[model samples]
Target: MAKNASKGASRIRVGVGGWTYEPWRNNFYPAGWPHARELEYAAGKLTAIEINGTYYSTQKPASFAKWRDDTPDDFVFSMKASRYSTNRRELATAGESIERFIGSGISELGKKLGPIVWQFMPTKRFEPEDFEAFLALLPHRVDGLALRHVVDVRHPSFKVPEFIALLRQYKTGVVYADTDEYPSFADITSDLVYARLMRSQADVDTGYGASSLDRWAQAAKTWAAGGEPADAPRVTSTPAPDTPRDVFIYFISGAKERAPAAALALLQRLL
Candidate 1:
């Protein structure tokens, strides 16, 4: 098990990946602008969402305000850090760039900024010097704000235990992605678990269409209740279940035009 498993809550915070295509436009409103209404609909069922599109394009202040107005008070958003901050660019010399990006994002989103997701591409192999310099460039505190940092290392070679340790040192959450392009959930290790369960398997798609939704809701309950296999394994020296910890589960199979339907399927399961 990873570090801080004891401190984190077990009750999974469920949600789908970010929205890309518009589904409500046909019936709800004209195509575009205020996506908050869509967010509100999604949040009514799921507790959280990972904002992937934000990295592709920055949102205006008015847009963030509208987003805040749309979603409920308890709902949380997990935003991706800008590509310029984590992509092919070298971080040591990019200190000014990183600072600028964070400053802009914070300024625009305010309270809705959520966790800063630094998702590196698989092509960008792990270089200790670059990574250390990169990590150092990140702002410890952004304008009196303590931003939550979550790292998604897509490179396979970057899965070294030392890399995980670095994440621990920064107190950054590591993304537990179930993807063939990068490392799998079992290979990746981190204290703060950010699981992205993409529905790549055929069973997942079919399952979503069937009774899997019910199963997820039930699973959510089970996870919330401190996980099953109640008794600690007699052989191993793993820590016993002491208290529940918060788990974030994001379903991502909705990249298509049928996103709303996918979102709805996930919402049904989450609800």
Candidate 2:
């Protein structure tokens, strides 16, 4: 739900979380640009953008269609499911709410719909049975198009093997959180990989230091080639899947002023 976005190979998608930032006007976007053209302009720059707006409210079908059309042919958008589904007292009681979120004209995005990020609160403890039931509620498809689901658990207790095993059982990937405030687990469970980097420095042109980007670039290559960085955090002690992973990395809106530049800088290295 926070702002960010990139690295590695053809399966990689690099970009920010949202595009309608007022600070981005003179910083990332060109000065005096039209307000309505923000999505159109930002879409062209990043290969993908996480639909953070959807996390707050349900968007109309027309709006979804417009967003799909505004981006380039290969552009992908990962949406965050509504908090109403996850913030409830019990995770098992979210079936109808999750269904409502999926039925909210998300199909209008068609193939442009990438993955759905289900982020949990930092206080949301990892309950094996309840969490597994919640995962079961995730539909594999909506309107005949298959979906990819990624979970972002912020609780420090999620750094357990059982949680990772449960995610692997559901074929769900875990978000590789690169922030001190969240639990940063880098375990790979699905064909896709999701990462949100938040340690951007406003003074740095690329948001990240040169060495950090280099390490990320290398780690991305490892991920794309079906491997992992030796230094990355992990909950599962077992090995990663043998197949290649589609990587999605982002330099999120931490040091907000330089996010886009960081994404572009990382994407440039990959390209």
Candidate 3:
């Protein structure tokens, strides 16, 4: 049971959050600069990046094209939907806004738009009426688009089984996060997985620490197994033995300096 499962399944892409800096670890980049070449050099080491910057502002098409030109063909990009669309619970009413966002990326990002993550704040409560209405509207929301949808609910109250079931019902990808803010790597319900491993406070800046790479690697292996399990277990000690699959892993580090280092550590362990 502990053997490798994703042997022949598919390869997963590993990446870090944005190319920006935070005060948490001195500074990610130099004193005053956001260089595309530098970002591309760093991104080349990974397969994808989670564009959190778009959460605060709209993405320009020219900028998107530049990013595409900077990165390799295998590289993928995942963008978080704006706060107005997600945190405001405007899902039922953000149709036109969502369309604009998608339109801006269609030509630039093209096939590289991995997922549009709707990261909800912890304060928000899951009102079934509002939630169901939102879910019901998803299919029609992306009617003509080619991108997949992903949700990352940070509130502990949103971890119920039914919430996840709803994700699978719509063929949406659940953000498999490793965080203390909520449960650690909650059971996922879909085959097309979108995940991020945030550093837990209990972990060291380096080594295996508390990043949950082991769990993810194991899960990826298990998922690589041909037959789906009757149900996902509370925890996995060993993932099933199967071929490898095309897995995508993103590391959104709370500790700045350790972001790339931690990502490399997991990559070494995984590949």
Which scores better on lDDT, 1 or 3? 3
Using Cα atoms with residue i matched to residue i, what is each candidate's TM-score against the true structure?
0.71, 0.95, 0.78
Pairs of residues at least 3 apart in sequence or in different chains that clash in candidate 2: 4-16, 4-252, 5-15, 5-250, 5-251, 6-14, 6-249, 6-250
lDDT of 2 at 155: 89
Question: 158-241 in candidate 3: lDDT tens per residue?
Answer: 656667666656767677776666544334444556667776332465524744666656665555453333444333333322
Q: After superposition, how far is residue 179 of candidate 2 from its true place, in Å?
A: 1.2
Query: Which regions in candidate 1 have their CA more than 4 angstroms from the true location?
Result: 1-11, 23-36, 105-112, 185-191, 200-245, 253-271
| Ten contiguous residues minimizing lDDT sum, candidate 3 | 1-10
As for TM-score, the candidate ahead, 2 or 3, is: 2
Candidate 1, residues 1-271, lDDT tens digits: the string is 2211122344356566664445445532345546646667666655677887767876666766666677776666777777877776675776766777676645444554566778887788878778877777777677676676777777777767667656656666677664565675322123334667554344343324556455544544554455533331112233324345345667665333333444456555544
Give the lDDT ranking, best first: 2, 3, 1
The candidate that wins on lDDT is 2
Per-residue CA lDDT of model 2 for 180-233, tens digit only, reads 988898898888889999999988988998888888878877788789889998
Candidate 3 is scored at a TM of 0.78
lDDT of each: 0.58, 0.86, 0.62
